[model samples]
Target chain A: MRARIVDKNDILKIVDILRKDHEVIAPFQGRGRDSFFDVVTDANRDQVKMHLHNPYYPPKRYVLPHIEKLFDIDQAKMDVKAAYVEPKRAIFGIRSCDVHGIYHLDRFYLGRDYKDPYYERLRRGLFLVNVVCTDKELDIDNGCFCMCANTGPASTEHFDLQLMDLGDVYMAVAGSPKGEALFADPIFKRGDDSHVQRRRSILNEVRKHFKLAVNWYSAAVRYITTGQVPEELWAQVGNRCLECGACTYLCPACTCFTVADRKVDGKVVERVRLWDSCALSGFTRMAGGHNPRRAVHDRRNRRFFRKLAHYFVQRELSMACVGCGRCIDVCHGDIGMPSVVEIIRRGCAGKENDSTIIKR
Target chain B: MTQPSSNDKNIYLPKVAILDRVQDEIQEVKTFFWHFENPADQEEFKKFRPGQFAQVSIFSQGEFPASLPPSPTEKETFFTVRTVGSVTSGLHQLKAGDKFAVRGPYGNGFPMEQYYGRNLVFVAGGIGLIPLRSCIIYALANRDRYKKIQVFYGSRSPRELMYTQNLREWEKIEGFEFYTTVDRGDADWKGNVGVVGSLFKKPDVKVPVENTTAFVCGPPIMFRFVIKDLKDMGFHDRDIVSTLERYMKCGVGKCGHCCIGMAYVCTDGPVFTYEQIKKLGEDI
Candidate 1:
């Protein structure tokens, strides 16, 4: 199928068409500079902003909500019921970085051996409408590093419908059969090669717009995998980290969760999985109070090494980080991934750094 | 990918098991023998191995990753739970006939086949013996296949010692050396009184570093000291094996709580050699 075009006048029509049958969720402005992936409704249809900032939180909540009930237990009856409900949703205007985020999560939750039922249920039959991010404009915050993470500008797959801005009209590309079916609405027309060339030029022009860039990602991978990272560097990074765990929660690819049983009432109970972070000291602590990674530095080091190390990246088949940089905003101690990488890069380059400095 | 235990059931979905019998192991730890109300459930769960664990659940109280303390050779299945957290405390209040949920014999358990021709030395501190119990019993049951099996266990005091009945029985077995000690002695206690490592000082306790595999499990401080002692005794990092514990939400690897570096405690181990642990880059 040919790549199609949707004029500015028809953009809202496409959203309305999708919203008719499925629950449409799109980006909307949240007080001042904050952006959020909110449930878009007819009353707030005009509030949907395609070029708005990428939400501080990744779009993972659509599939893996922050808190989800995995099962319900009846104590008196002695039975377990899996709480899995798959709801059809059309998520619009997701950035390329976040599309990759979903892909990385797919690799984990839908593992070869054991697949998470709740996550699979939530992920089934999902419709994604992604907007290619050409620059830092539509939600690429300052600490962004998607270029190094290799999920930037645009995604060639996963998106049901991928849209690129071309001034008067948006170049729409269909990645799947479901995405091609949307072109049948007659609002889309076959896009010419000029439109493709315009996209290439725009990508070239916007390449320099990222506030952050990771030139030494491979260097960090080598040093981290080979265990060349000095112990003192980890201690330094650890001291700067507050162990708040905001970094992991805000990160688009961090998939760790903690489960607990909550009493809904006297006789009812629900087992829930809540987003958990390894930065917290209690994450690896045992029942009898023995924690292997007790030091703040050890936890800090583990997070980076797990994400960027060659062994894990190869095992996972993709680097866990898409470089969305949500960690930078949520971090209070200024030891987010970008900062940590810079520290490691500096150390690798033989520069002795002393303090944790937060810079945009 | 490791083969799924059940193709039909969700990995996280637990099976209901009734608490049938409870045996007091020590002051803080108790062994609970549980079986599924459905007889068919028992047949499938009988496949659990040594060093693996199950997620024991109490309806409104939550769940815990409790190691399977009963050997595969035993007809019954049980968890030797120590009251260390809220979940275990909730489990403590439950009586026989009260039902709870359990799923899995998770983790890469002690690779028994690899250690077939090697001498097995079991070292544990306090409640750490809970996991090693299954493997120790399995080794004892298959005694002809392996040579020279010894158990070195210690506790804070004589009263804190666990599985006294089994310990005494194992002591009576010919050629089976069972050594016990206490950090401090009691009036009625007449035995070696020192940390678990002190048991090595006994002239009869000979841990051959070559052609031998030593399994260690204990408190963090005890784990460190014991590993150091084993290294000093000329044991290779690969020769010393141990089971690790971590706060786990999902017994499957998806939940990140049990991960240290690249390895997830719920998957790659609860059982790992020192060489593997060192490469894992996470302190243990």
Candidate 2:
């Protein structure tokens, strides 16, 4: 809870300090309107943008990679060796929703009875630098619902360091001792209560910028938990789904995966796990061809039920949806969280009989 | 941050197990007897309860979940796998002295001690007898704790019956009632020539409906018909139990592949009562 101020131009100096001990990754503008997170080396250090659209792909992959090796097997000796990679890394300019996404992953992977050693290893080395969203033109979008999801426009906790824009100066707050150590650098100047007031007023103004603000999130959760949403509504939603699995892949909180073993040079075998989607038909199909969730509508029902249901939310102590809106942006069928919630809200209001809302 | 030491236990890592023997139970299905290379691992695995399962790794092929067919009280550990996929087919090709790896004793196994002094009925069709074999042997080992035990097993034909050696032994247990049937009987077949459910209505047979629990496992069609028969006989939904199968990668609860409704079949159950199974809202 210590605050400091740095000049707008010297913000990269914080990245420089972090890079001395860790490989700092930050957001950079790609093609028009696209942004991505990459390593901030000397060549790309100057290109690190302080403000841009949140990347389509989540930063959770940094902690839990898309494909991770679980074991290396020596075929002849029948020896099995566990594999892991733990590089000291810092992700700079992460959004608040993505920060909460990592917290959800922590609850599911480490807080459970059996801890996932692979996720535990990578997460131990991660440093989060959360950037509060202030710029309406670049940061806020129509798809964002972080205000309703209660994760943004500024996070209250769960970050190592948090940065806020204040015109000429960037006010930085340290949430951990590791982040407070960076305040000793010459680029940082001590700030008083007046700067904290500025941070509060700026956050209040930025919260109004989100266009898709609605408070039906809890109502949707209630309907899903109680199973009040009729089967017809799910069928209508499932009819529009293309099953491309982009929604689950781009989601920051989704953590399903499938494992496989492949031969290497005909001497060893490597067991690897790749990110999996429940939307795929093969995800639940057993070896003898019996699939429990064979219907497309049943698969569509699973994605939302896992997120908004009370049982899962209570089990993990956090809702799986962070309101990052990447699913809204990436979904080809227009059946993202907000759309699905709207469908449920309308369906519960007796509009389900109307063909306009439930077209069947 | 501290690096994990070599001695730290990794749940995903499998221990080496060497195949001691193999028995071809039926066509395309074989039971492999194996033990962990380390005595410590074998000692730990022996504590597994019936209805639990293990992940078997075939090195270059892949890993698959298999039911532990041997009871904790049995002399050996084995897996009865039918060649259904690439991983199982790779296991079928292995000979004696071949090396593989295994992890677990995972899932909530049947709570056998809770069913003490109650009559037990076991109904299985074809290879569905694999998981139930463990429970049957465990019950027979502690035979004084139960009142009565009845077993009814059926297959497509006389040639497709599993665990014939154990079936022959159980039929001669004097006080126990053992029945076998086949959908189609060959010339040498003479015991019964109907579905497994037909044994429930035979003139000489009487199935106890009071203070009795029925364990049913088989193909989905058989399960549906047998469940109706059990319900018609006034068996409560809570008294009918079965094990479910799903495509799984991690035998632990981390992977979401085996999740149904709000429960993970890996953790909450592979063994569930008919009442609990109905709440899962998914087809068997």
Best by TM-score: 2
The models' CA-based lDDT, in order, is: 0.84, 0.90
Measured by DockQ, the strongest candidate is 2
Model 2 residue B124 CA deviation (Å) reads 1.2
Tens-place lDDT per residue, model 2, B168-234, is 8998997789999999999999989999999999999999999999999999899999999999999
After TM-score superposition, the amount by which residue A176's alpha carbon in candidate 1 deviates from its true location, in angstroms, is: 2.0
Best by lDDT: 2
Q: What TM-scores result for chain A when each predicted structure is judged separately against the true chain A?
A: 0.94, 0.96
- Residue by residue across A1-360, what tens digits does model 2's lDDT show? 888999999999899999989989899999998999999999999999988999998999998899999988889887777888889999999999999999999999999878898898898989999999999999997799988888998888889999999889999989899888888998889888888888889888998889988958787898788677899999999998999899998899999999988877788889999999999999999998888888898999999999999999999888899999998888889999999999998888653345444553
Tell me the deviation in Å of residue B15 in model 2: 1.3
DockQ of the candidate models in sequence: 0.69, 0.77
lDDT of 2 at B30: 99
Clashing pairs in 1: A53-A139, A54-A139
DockQ of candidate 2, scored on C-alphas against the true complex (2 decimals): 0.77
